[model samples]
Target: MDNPTAGIDRAAPVVARHELTIRAPATAVWGLLTDVPAWPSWQPDIVSARARTPLTPGATFHWRTAALDIASTVYAMEAPRLILWGGPAQGIVAVHQWTLTSSGPAATLVTTEESWDGAPVRADAANIRQALDDSLAQWLGHLKTAAEKPR
Candidate 1:
């Protein structure tokens, strides 16, 4: 498969990557990941989220988080596997990607990667990196909890 974040420089100073294993099927994880409006329920940092149009390539979504409000466009989407989206917010340009792999009949390996650039990100790389790391970790934990619960 093509690299979802191909254009973004991985060596950039303000980049954050996180991965976690979820004991659930990829379909379940993918459903939760793509449901934009439901994000705030599991993602503590997200204040609100609404898709401006259907979630497909070039479609946009507005997201409000504790740090900033961003208008993100879906750059890539591969059902039950990968989704990538990002945009500029508060002087920072960001690209976020989520990849899911089914490890077994009822297990999955989930990874979330994000890259940030622009003036604000470069000005405070350390804090931005830490914040992104923490946020990603929290997101993964929330996903694990949500996915692990019995339906």
Candidate 2:
């Protein structure tokens, strides 16, 4: 079980990073993130989301994405802070973490981190990683726009 994320620096991993500083508070950003119905309005990749349990540490969720028709459980959740989860791809599991922090003056820094576990059977691990990375970038950009929009 080698570290899939090893040899990659914070500046950039083998997979790309999608980051944005939202001009809204963490709470506001979290609201947009956790809102199931609104996700499809902004996040083109996420087809749907439903809470299997209240947003507790061990609470669960069903996340469906258009990219892979994948549904993953919510492994971790903390409002105005973090959401972590993963889904299986050809027996290889992929994990992702979304973290939000207050930057200042009603601003929040949002970061998405992703990693894969197990060898990829497709032998296109790099391409797959890049696709995931690009998707995250699109997602984050959409979030930034949505968060900044007047409500």
Candidate 3:
């Protein structure tokens, strides 16, 4: 990792974390993950994504998922290794991070974690946690399929 990972809010009422080993190089997985506009193609949970501004620190991107429109700002980014982004949506504040570690010649140990805090999340912590867990799992599965695709 070129840069240290930025963590999610520890005090957040709801948190979800998931990790998976993908049979693809870190660079390959990072490529697919960072390409926001192409997210809907691989990550079915996302309805759309657009980043008119380059994905540097403080740059914001808008996307829709699970019927919620989210506008997330790129908080930190370390190419092929880590990225942290989040924002407020539907009265909930979310902080999400993705970390990719090269495990072998063509493998990556990828981890995704998110923290949520706000009235809605606190009101239904159990359901929100489960939903975030399911969403992250599906995201990892889809990334694995996309990155492992024959080039």
* Candidate 1, 1-151: lDDT as tens digits: 1343463448667777889999999999998888999999887778999986679988999989876889998888889898889888888888888999999989999999888888888899999899989988999999999889899
- Ranking, TM-score, top scorer first: 3, 1, 2
Name the weakest run of 10 consecutive residues (lDDT summed) in model 3. Answer: 1-10
lDDT of each: 0.86, 0.70, 0.90
**Which candidate tops TM-score?**
3
Off by over 4 Å in 2: 1-14, 119-122
Residue-level lDDT tens digits of model 2 in 11-73: 222345677899998998889877765688888778876775555544446666754555555
| Candidate with more favorable, higher TM-score: 2 or 3 | 3
Clashes found in each candidate (C-alpha, N, C closer than 3 A): 0, 0, 0
Q: Report model 2's TM-score to 2 decimal places.
A: 0.78
**Ranked by lDDT, top first:** 3, 1, 2
Badly placed stretches (over 4 Å) of model 3 are 1-5
Return the clash pairs for model 1, or none: none
Candidate 3 scores a C-alpha RMSD against the true structure in Å of 3.4
